[model samples]
Target: MSSQLLMIEDDTRLAEMVGEYLGQSGLHVTHRADGKSGLAQLQGPEAGPLPDLVILDLMLPDMDGLEVCRRIRSLQGPAAQVPVLMLTAKGDPMDRIIGLELGADDYLPKPFEPRELLARIRAILRRRTDGGTPAATPALRFGSLEIDRDARTVTVGGQVADLTSYQFDLLVTLAERAGRVLTRDQIMEAVRGRELDAFDRSIDVHMGRIRAAIEADAKNPRRILTVRGVGYVFAKQQD
Candidate 1:
């Protein structure tokens, strides 16, 4: 079955062009002109079912892209967990990081090639599909925290933790090697299967977001601790 994608963008020309381009790659694209209408089609009564993925634009007429992303994450049940790929003309690193922190599965700056967009879309969807497969290791438990590797879900104190797919994998990597310190590069390599850019602090951003979800006090996280001048470590045992 073709994947369904909801594109919340005001640029009709770009949406139409991209929609047609992505349609050629086996995805069905639905375009909405503004954030409100997009959200309405996304979760309104007549919206039917949620799409497989969302391609959201940062500059919406009704609301900023971050607000829309926040509202989407605020949704309950399966609809809230729908994957999102954020797009914007802004090239600020903070903007990308903020988008990811707010549950965006991926980020892409505007003026990008259609092929790059398609590649990113495929990559995000592939992660979701691959994560559903069972892992060789069983679920890990730490105090009140539970990490289900196979299902890629985390529950803290018996409540679901709001984490993006990347954040979940990062947490699992740390948990699996509990008590061991890992540098940002090591953590990135383990989770992303690639090397990390020294200048990119996305790993740290993801860690902060994960701590917010699972820690009692994200400001002073006890589960994942920061080691001065080194990296981070998941506690061997939480007190």
Candidate 2:
């Protein structure tokens, strides 16, 4: 079956172009002009099946895209877990960071190539399906934290930890190589099959979010420790 995608964008021409382009690649694309209607479709009973992913624009006529992301994450049931790939014209990294903090699976700046968008979409969906974990062990335990590969869930102290799909995969990558310091490029390649941009701090932002979800003290994270000049390591010993 073709993957379903919802695009909440205010640009009519852009939406049409995206829809037609992605449709040719065996993806079903639905478009809404503003945030409210897009969100209503997700919340409405007649919205049919939930979309596999959402392509959201940062600037919207009705509401800010960040607010939309926050609301989506707050929704009950499967809708809340639907992966979001944020779009923004702004070059500011803060917008992307904020979106990630609010549970967006990924973000793309405007003026992006159609192929890159398609690639990002595929990567996110692929993570959801395979999780890139091929080990016989279905779960990994480190003190109070538990990562279940099959279920794609993380728990700390028996309580479910809320992490975006991308973050969860990142955690899994680090855990799979526990105690080994992985540079940003290595970690990004491991999880997403891509190298990190020289200036892209998105990985660090995601690590902070993961720490916030799983660590008792995010500022003093015990499970994921940052090396001064290199990258990050998933501590083998954790409480």
Candidate 3:
């Protein structure tokens, strides 16, 4: 069966084009032109079962795309866990960072090739699926911290840590290579399966967030140590 995708976009032409392309790729898409309708589709029972993923445009006629992203995240259970890929016309990296911090799984700058969009969508979905598997390694334990590759969850002191999907993947990558120093480029490539955009600080931002959630003292992180001039290492801890 095809995966259901909800696209909240205002451009009719672009929506049709993207819908047709994604449909050809075996995804069933439902398009909403504005934020209000998008929210209704997500909240109203007629929206059918929750979509497998959401492609949200940052600009809408009635509301900010970021606000919509927040609402989607606020939904209960599986609905709140839906993967979201943001589409933005703003070239500022801050917007993308804010969107990611607000629960967007990924972001694509507007005026992009359809193929790239498809690749991003596939990447996010792939991560949501078997991305955590195939590691050939068992769950990692670090004292009070637990990184469950099979379950794709992280817990600190037996309490579930609220991490974005990307953050979870980042933690897994670092843990899988405990004690090895991985540069920012290496970490990004390993977790995202892509290179960082030179100046992209999203990786650091994510690392800080992860530390805050898992570390005993985020201000002085011990598990993920910064090497200053080098990279970072996942301190081999004792349970």
TM-score of every prediction relative to native:
0.87, 0.95, 0.91
For residue 229, give model 2's deviation from the true position in Å. Answer: 0.7
Candidate 2 per-residue C-alpha lDDT over 1-239 given as tens digits, one digit per residue, 9 for 90 to 100: 89999999999999999999999999999999998889987887547789999999999998989999999999888899999999976578889989988989999999899999999999999989764556666689999999998888999999999998899999999999999999999999988899889999999989999999999999998889999899999999957
Residue by residue across 34-74, what tens digits does model 3's lDDT show?
99888788877556788888999998989989999999888
**Which residue pairs in model 3 clash with each other?**
none
State the weakest 10-residue window (summed lDDT) of model 2.
Answer: 129-138
- Candidate 2's TM-score: 0.95
Give all candidates' CA lDDT scores.
Answer: 0.86, 0.92, 0.86
Writing each residue's lDDT as its tens digit, candidate 1 over 125-203 gives: 8767764545476789998999987777899878988788778878988999999999998998776556877877877
Stretches of model 1 off by over 4 angstroms after superposition? 131-137
Better-scoring candidate (TM-score), 2 or 3:
2
Candidate 2's C-alpha runs over 4 A off are: 131-136
Pairs of residues clashing in candidate 2 = none
Worst 10 residues of 1 by lDDT: 128-137
The parts of candidate 3 lying over 4 Å away from their true place are: 131-137
